[model samples]
Every structure is written in C-alpha cells, then in structure tokens.
Target: MPRYLISFEKGAMDHIPEEDFPEVGKTSHAVIQEAKDAGVFLFGGGLRYDDGDVEHAVVGTDGVVTDGPYPESKELIGGVMIVDVPTREAALEWAAKIAVACRCAQDIRKFMYDPDLIE
Candidate 1:
C-alpha cells in the first residue's frame, strides 16, 4: 500500500472556537478511529501554534541545526494523518469524508516514494 499525507487545511481554523469545538473534535476523533479501523492510520496529530524550540536555526558545513517551518505560510498546518492506501483515489475519498466531518477543505497529497530521484 502507498502512504499519503492527509492534511487538514488552515481554512478549518475558522471553525475553531473556545465555546467548545465539540462538533469538529468529535468528527476528528471519528475520522482517526475510522482510519484505524480501515487499517490505514500510521501516525498523525494536530500541529502546535508555538513552542520554545528554536523557531529558526541553521547548521553550516561545520554541522548545525535549524528550526521553524522551512517555508512559512499564512495558514499553518493545523493537523495531519498518515495512512496506507492503495491509490490516490482512495485517499481522496477519505479526504472528502474528513472534509464533510470537519466542514472545511482538506489538502490531500500523495507521499512520494522516489527511488531513482527522477522527477
């Protein structure tokens, strides 16, 4: 089976509120369980807004480490899910289901397993 990254887009942030994102939360959990039941879930979770970790760090040829999202975007990666599926179509199907549950658009991209590195 092929692996895919099913990202819950940033637009979904609009639905979040302190009042209790019960609906969204419920659906998210359901989706996770569904993925587990389908035997596709690998590992996934929501992204944090900020942390004490180095937001930006760099390593020269001398050897260094860096932090922060390589390339930043106005919308952050809200959450993620890794699943093993047979095809992109199948992943898209699952993404669509998640979109309905979360009431937000989802970005589903197939993971590249390049061997020869010929793109």
Candidate 2:
C-alpha cells in the first residue's frame, strides 16, 4: 500500500474565529473518523504551537546536536495525517475533504519508501 501525507500550514486556520473552533474540530474529527472506518487512516495529529516546546535542533555529521530549525524555516506544520490508500487520486480526495472540513488548504504528499526500513 502507498502512504500519503495530508498536511496544512501552521496558522492556516487562524482566521477562523475562536468561537467556531469547536465546530471546526468536530467537523475535522468526523472526517478523520470516516477515514479510519474506511481503513485508510494510519495516524494523524496537530502539532504543539507553543514557542517554548517548539524548539528546533540540528544533528551535525560529527554527532553533535545544535539548536535552531536548521535553515531557519518560518513555515511549520500545523497538522498532518497519514493515509494508506491505493492511489494518488484517492489521497487527493482525502486531502480535499480535510481542507473543506477544516476550512483550510491541504497538501498531499507521498512518503518516500526506504527498503531497509521495511526489511
């Protein structure tokens, strides 16, 4: 099976009013549940947005870990879901559903397979 990543940018849905968050949450959860029932969902969750815990680290070739988000990326992943489906179109369909439910744009990506990891 091929796995696809459905993701949205951090703050992408910030324009959504605080009062409407509950509804958005409910709608998104319903879609997630639907995906699970269809046996396409693998895993999904939102990232922590607090600056304190959102520390970045870089691992040097010398085996030393350093602070900072490497090249200093301004964009962060707000939320992501992994789905194992049969085709790219199916994944896109899932992303579309999530986008509508969450009231935000969603991106679809295929996971790079590592043969060593499988065997």
List of clashing residue pairs for candidate 2: none
* Best candidate according to lDDT: 2
> Compared with the true structure, what per-residue lDDT tens digits does model 2 show for residues 32-112?
999999999999998875767635667889999887666866677899999999899999999999999999999898988
Best candidate according to TM-score: 2
TM-score (C-alpha, index-matched) for candidate 1: 0.72
Q: After superposition, how far is residue 10 of candidate 1 from its true place, in Å?
A: 4.2
> Model 2 off-target regions past 4 Å?
72-74, 115-119
lDDT of 1 at 106: 81
TM-score per model over all chains: 0.72, 0.86
The alpha-carbon lDDT assigned to residue 102 of candidate 2 equals: 94
TM-score of 2: 0.86
lDDT of residue 95 for candidate 1: 84
What's the distance in Å from true for residue 61, model 2? Answer: 2.8
